[model samples]
Target: MKKVIPYIASNFKKDKIWMRRTKPSKRQYQVVFAIDNSESMIDNNSGELACEALCLITKALSLLEVGEISVVSFGEKTELLHPLDKPFSDNIGGSILSQLAFKDKQTDVSGMVSFVVQMLSHSRNQSINFSENLQIVFVISDGRFSNREEIRKFIIEAYSQQQLFVFLIIDHPKNSNSILQLQTISYPNGKLTCSPYLDNFPFPYYIILREIKSIPEILADALRQWMEMISSSFL
Candidate 1:
């Protein structure tokens, strides 16, 4: 049992007040990053950056109390760099992230969707109550889909889970259209754009999920802002 249920009764005794149970269970965040390593993301070292940034984020997320991080890299193949069953800890997060190997084949977004959907489903089933377990799925891609309809179907199904929050990456026009029907997460305007060159991109403060070939300190900022927005709802 976590927290005192609101509006509960407090009884007055001879000299003491009897109160309801107030044991609090900590709210934990399980963040999963699914990065695209498909052939399409090879340009400008995007594939390499995907893995690197994921590692950085994983390390950062471990700083939070009761935070767990898992990563899945997909090309034509989907590989689980970090297992979802394991909880993230500061000492081991980096080692787990470094194991994210990639395959250079055509991008199969539908396959990625299916793999993550299954993984999340399995993870959810582990806990009977999901209210204290927040599952955040970050799908970062160049926005190329071999089967849009199939991916769309899986995305909607995943959204039905109260704890899952799916954030799709936007880099091309095609990426924009894929998310038109999917509004599972309330993103800052339902759009996420990445500039090839962050310097050329205006107003760095507004950036979310920027495609930085070189790591940016702003990524930490973006994550903090994101964490703040979802804290009231989940935490």
Candidate 2:
């Protein structure tokens, strides 16, 4: 005996391109950005730089007509700075960027992951019209995780449910070697690395370091590149 799969589309009548019976539904995409706010982030102008980067990214996203975005920051605890359900507006971006609060405490990576998972799950359940196309999670951190195994497990769990994209931002030069080591072990398929500290070399390291003071353009470009990559892959 052969089994048959039901064709729901067959139940509906076909229409022409210009003369359509049913109106096309709009597709909505949601992207969530998760930033790390550990004590280490406060050192070496990272906190300030991160704030600028976040402001730029959110500002850019506000201009895009594709989907909605939510921003979350985590240190010893996690907090939803912007709700995903809210409209992408200049006011929302300004409100989120204005809260440049950084904690001089440890970051709980696992806890942050748990918070994100819960948010995604809740959103998925509550959403009446949701797309399963792209769910992005960008993580910016300077140091390697103390709870490496737990973080890995959380990533795995997240991946099991939705597509995961991690953007690890290394802000400190002192943790360069450690960052490389962590990237080697923690990141799968070599998808993570340190943010470039130098734009042009052979001039002066201090010049490059000073230029790093402005992170808004850097992060905005990085996110734009990532989105372009995703679009290209789809094409």
Candidate 3:
């Protein structure tokens, strides 16, 4: 416990490493997640996957900055599991595990994105110096989102504001009708394509995750992305 104290004191400011989608700073760190918890995803252990992924990602973010996380779960409908810009409560992970493991609904990527954007916009507005804040949003799903254009539009809009948006589409049997297939349609935008295995930043970054299925892998990828983002500063 003695050793941990000084570490906490020194690292408390790590939260200052905030990224409103790019450039990790050591303040105002927030993690926004728009998760698809439809029955299918749950059946495929996506709920468990979510639990693992969230823990891993949050741990990585914590290293650079103390982070606040909000989660929005969506299906044919959407509900806020955690409100945007709020500090994480105790045992929050257990609450999320129960929700994701049991949630039933339809896939509505657009709706989820809309909810995320609204909440984030509100938080950003409340900030007098949004330019000084850093935040990252994660949109995780198992496919079959209903609105393509709307999701695309909001992503572009969020990116314009310099907020990092990640679409982690883990494949499952229920995704049979999933139209998020990359080959059939172009990704986020022509110039803004991305992969979860690595982070891409044209100017900053937007990650579209696919194929990754484990916590360690997720952590590696996330940490790599962070390193890439920080390293870009030298060039």
TM-score to native of every candidate shown = 0.60, 0.64, 0.65
Model 3 lDDT tens row, 98-178: 776445656777777667777777887798866555556776765544456667787777766656676665554344433
Which candidate should be chosen as best, given TM-score against the real structure?
Answer: 3
How does residue 229 of candidate 3 score in lDDT? 66
In model 3, the worst 10-residue window by lDDT is 196-205
Which model is ahead, 2 or 3, in terms of lDDT?
Answer: 3
| Local distance difference test scores for all models | 0.54, 0.56, 0.57
Residue runs of model 3 more than 4 Å from their true location after superposition: 1-26, 59-65, 101-103, 173-213, 226-235
Cα RMSD, model 3: 8.8
Tens-digit per-residue lDDT, 40-125, candidate 1: 66542345556555655554455323356787877878888778667766556556545544446677767776787788777767
Least well predicted 10-residue stretch by lDDT in candidate 1 = 1-10
Candidate 2 residue-wise lDDT, 90-174, digit = tens? 7877777566466637777788888887788678777775454456676655543466567667777776666455555555565
Per-residue error at 174 for model 2, in Å? Answer: 6.7
Candidate 2 whole-model C-alpha lDDT, 0 to 1:
0.56
Off by over 4 Å in 2: 1-27, 131-133, 173-235
Candidate 1, residue 233: lDDT = 44
Candidate that beats the other on TM-score, 2 or 3, i.e. the better one: 3
State in Å the error of residue 74, model 3.
1.2
